[model samples]
Target: MVLEVVGVSPEEESVYRLLVTSGRATAEDLAQRAGLPAADAARILDSLALKGLASHTDGTPRLFRAAPPDVALLPRLKRSADTLELARLEATRLIQAYQDTMRRHDAGQLLEVITGAEALRQHLRQIQTCAQDEMLWFCKAQYVAMPSGSNAEEFEALARGVRYRVLYEKAFFDDEGAVDNVVAGVRAGEVARAVPHLPLRLAIADRSVAVFPLVAGGPHGSPEEPTTALVRDSNLLAALIALFERYWEDAVPLRVDGSDALSGTDGSGPAEALSPTDRKLLSLLVAGVADKAIASQMGLSRRTVQRRIQAMMERAGAETRMQLAWHAAGHAWL
Candidate 1:
């Protein structure tokens, strides 16, 4: 570490150390002992004397002795501490002045990479707190959202009438009790949907801030350490929002039961909540949409949609697709 208080050059320190150890010594002797030239040694001793770290007497030649550290270094250290305090006071203005300059230039920071799962969770809570309008998410294949503060954060946001649209991958529904959990969320005022595939896990709030994982988790694969990014309002964030809307437009109803009273969701869940795309999916299932084409249009994969359909078929306790449809129609779930 640098000793800013003394602030002496290496050569000066060498000269001082030599004198302090040697008691009293001539410049010529110190120069030899300290590996410095005679003139350099003399100059350093005089400099140390000026700092009050050393004292000198003239006899046959000048002899120098170090002052006790308490008498010398202590005062210099105190002055340094005082100077640092003054700098600390001025730092507030300096920082704000810089921020003002950046604002005037219309230049500022917008993106940040966040590391560590706990820290990311903290940021999630912060994001919820900061949100003012809507929240969007693309949670795929696994539990990407490590619940922050015991599920209180999302509930608080929902309680405030903030819009929530969450998309899930087919894999997200495979977990035990997943349907029950989703029904709970639907009851809590979140419009939810599922697609064949999701490219990444993401959370965007108020159209102002967005986060996407750098590490994969859930069905994708659990990482010991997870990381994500927080991108502020920018072209990248806009593109992400657009991507979600496209998927939302084609997404099928994530419904187990058709009763609006049971869930309180305004019939926006995929299935009977039909757009032209859902109708096409319904029609094409009879002929087939060439999995790739359907997946592309729906922002998921053919396999993902296939898996979801199969899961629904099994939930209906049916052995075939026709049976699944008949069973669903009986409950008006289609």
Candidate 2:
């Protein structure tokens, strides 16, 4: 019993044995039997009393006796030990959280310059390949309009049941080829949409990583002059996803028929609602063509195309070309 309380110490067991055999003894008698000093025996007796394993009787000379063995003390001791360990673990977790916050504060802005079109393409492919559940994209028409190897990879991922939600500009409706591709994707039923003038080009995969263009303009500039950033941190990715959802809430739906209607206008519209020049400009925008390329294609000055796009923004009530495209596509106006 004493071994269970104080562990297997030679002195404690010897003292317990002396107390048991002698029935009750003075500290001096216990010390002689246990081969320990009188002061040592007194200290051990006090420790045993504190443990409730033994008691000292009050008399002319104090004498110790082993208490009735209590089976309940073993489980009580174990529970107390477990409670203390849990408190230690909780304190460690709180300290780790504080350390992580300090680390983020110590490291401010982080930037990396990755060169080459192929490098950029590979980076996008890597994100798609690693996506386990869902991929959300807010893209300009130019990204989907222009042919690239990444599209094939993205399509393959969709085929494997990786969920996808993409937003495109109204200009996509102007390009028969681009529209056809979108229709095909819609047929697959893996992608959902809101309409057109998407200014920000962003991609999020599985809530773990995000990619976006650094340059303010759409991708229609030169591929050689592309600027983008890929983010892998979870907190930053969540913030980016939140921003995308805010824009998505105000966007229009992609499908239009008797079933789909804007509150103010009837489903039917005049042909002049969108002119040929407007359609052409939208296509160029989706293709990520520069102002010079759009101007050359339409036989108009670059400034004219820019002005028309500004006018389109006003007509669409859009702040950015990306938002304009999203709204246009959703309304089926583009």
- TM-score of every prediction relative to native: 0.48, 0.44
Q: Give model 2's TM-score versus the native structure.
A: 0.44
- lDDT (CA) per prediction: 0.71, 0.66
lDDT of 2 at 216: 51
Q: Which 10 consecutive positions of candidate 1 have the poorest summed lDDT?
A: 261-270
Q: Which stretches of candidate 1 lie over 4 Å from their true place?
A: 1-108, 144-150, 215-223, 256-273, 277-334
Q: Write the per-residue lDDT of candidate 2 for residues 1-334, one digit (tens) a residue.
A: 5454325356665676677678888889888877789899999888777766678878857978886645425655677678878999999999977766764765332223445455666777888888888888775655522342227767778888888887665654554466556555655654545544665778888976677766553354554456667765546667889987755543444543343331212112222355566777887886678889899989989887888788667767789988877767777655
Model 1 C-alpha lDDT per residue in residues 1-334, reported as the tens digit of each score: 3444568777777777778889988889999998878998888889999988899896769888998878877787888899889998899889977765664565345667787777777887888877888899886654645631254677788998888788877766666656666777777887887766778888899998888876654432455667678887667889999998877765666654665323212323424655555445545554545657767777867886676566556545778877856765675553
